[model samples]
Target: MKVVSRIINVVLVIVVLCSLVAAIGSAITKEPMLLTVIRSNSMHPVWERGDMVIIENLKEEKTIHKEDIIFFKTEEGSLSKQGWIAHRVMSGSREEGFITKGDANKYTDQSSDGTVPIKQEWVAGKAITIGETPIVIPKIGYLSLWAEKFQSNPLLIPVIALVLAGLIAFGEIKFTKKRKKKSQGMELQLIYIVGGLTIAVIMGGTMLTSGQNLGLAYQVSDKSQGVIMGSDVGILKVGDKVSRPLSELSNNGAFPLIGTINTSDKQIELSHERVILSKGEQIKSTYTVKAEIPGKYESSIRVGLFYPFLPASLIYFLSEQSYWLALVSVSLVPGLPLMVYPFVNGKMRRKTAKLLRRKKRKIQSSLPF
Candidate 1:
């Protein structure tokens, strides 16, 4: 039982460490081509929905060739609206951009017109395929796809975290009891350790939930005059501000627009009101969004939660320094006393034993010596 518990604990620790590493690595890379799960069957028979695929960004446009499978930024107003697409390179050259087509599709993405080709700048990455076979890990992406459906509901995260904490604490209690039946005093100490760890986990999970619910960051691509992306659950309360780098445009035609601010649960204000952004080369602005209601709401262009959903949340939680620091603080507050009590109690016991021995010696010496 002890060995098994130790192993389980070790595995959990390793998972947490790996999550932190992955999150940091992804941030440093600046590209989203780390690991993404397929949500569509556009590249069917080869890679299906719920299949996990690793993406590596193509460094140079010259390396791209016909027949290679590549992932690129999706055009606006597409059915999926996922911002990215993966397809086979049907035809093109470096100078004349590329026209990609899904293997299962009848025509190209542009549907045979071929007038508007995917620019070299738009290509994100090329799928690493072995010969004609695309290497894929099957059925693992279901978690991601399922999470996307509930991605709007941020509250689910804390609820899940609380449940996990309770379950873990219960398991630890049982395991400690079964392992240390003789050491009754150590039971409470073990609980302290277990409870502290559990609380830390819950805190980390809650941090992730809050970030997903409240905070967002996005970059305006050079190709796009304007773009909006976000979840419906994301609410910007009245007086809340969204700050981002604004692109400078010669004309007022391409100014930033925030649309569809919900007034009530049913009614919405279609806001096409243009706000003047700071001028010069690097135009940056923080638009203090107006909300009809004083509570949580969603914007038209909400941020998206990334792939491998739950794991992403965990990783994201660990990525921040504040969460880790808070975890340490919270864990140590209860854990320190529990850990020190055992040693402190041992010293007290030894002192008491020593005093008893001295008392015995004094009594003997006084009696008949």
Candidate 2:
């Protein structure tokens, strides 16, 4: 399993969960507190996407310390594109405010908004770790598509879920009971689940083929050079504008497309699966519409393993049920564990420290420093 993906999913679920907490918290308190989602990778490894946050507004004097995950409101970036960023406070104090930097970045972004000591009031709250968003829950965009298909016949989906759950649960229970009766007991049960999971992994892996699978017949988004198709990387034209499906486009190939860069096409100069059509080529005419490959319910799940959090989070956000309550509840659910995780982790750390100290003292008594 991809540890990063699991962490990201956990972040998304915690976000939904935290929103509920924030809602409740917001309702009960008479403060200017608010909650928002993590916008960037400023404070990563600790806080990933969909990580729910609690911003406790301290109006009078917002004090800060060395490493505080902060939500600093500022007029940074293009008004339209980069609205705000919530990064961790790298270093600073209440007097000099604080200098902040993203956990992942090499250097600090120390502007007034990026670096200055945030007034205690500007801060929201400390960040926390919740459980991961479930992988199964978010793929509902496809479900939503199917839901629309069965709109008039709505009961179709729920009935199916209930039925499937019931059947699987029943079979597993019966099989488990029978297995437990055997001499091998837990060993046999463990073996059965592991074997089943292994089969599933193989099946899922086989099913995933990737962009290369998009053949001549399958209509795919022709976001490439007008003349060439995918796997046919081309050069970038000065006047010909291009964009990629992904953020980072790797053009370290022989046929890098340098299409005419013009209006309507704006993206990273180099990114993959984006487009390389020249200025003249229309999005449609440039790329043949053989068979459009619809993006996954989530961002294309990382083919290999980085962490599927992005796609999973996307899937959760696009769940079939449009109810506000359901949406908020599910979003916060995964994050609830995150907030709890910090505390749990802190406790564990304290315990570990204490044990180390005791061991150290015993050693010192036996020997010397």
Best candidate (score: lDDT): 1
Cα RMSD (angstroms) for every candidate in the order listed: 15.7, 23.1
**Which tens-of-lDDT digit does each residue in 237-301 have in candidate 1?**
34333333222222121222111111122223223112222222222222234333453333322
Model 2: lDDT of residue 94: 65
Off by over 4 Å in 1: 1-31, 75-80, 112-115, 149-151, 180-369
Worst 10 residues of 2 by lDDT: 298-307
Q: What are the runs in model 2 whose C-alpha is more than 4 Å off?
A: 1-35, 54-57, 76-81, 111-121, 128-369
Worst lDDT run of 10 residues, candidate 1, spans 256-265
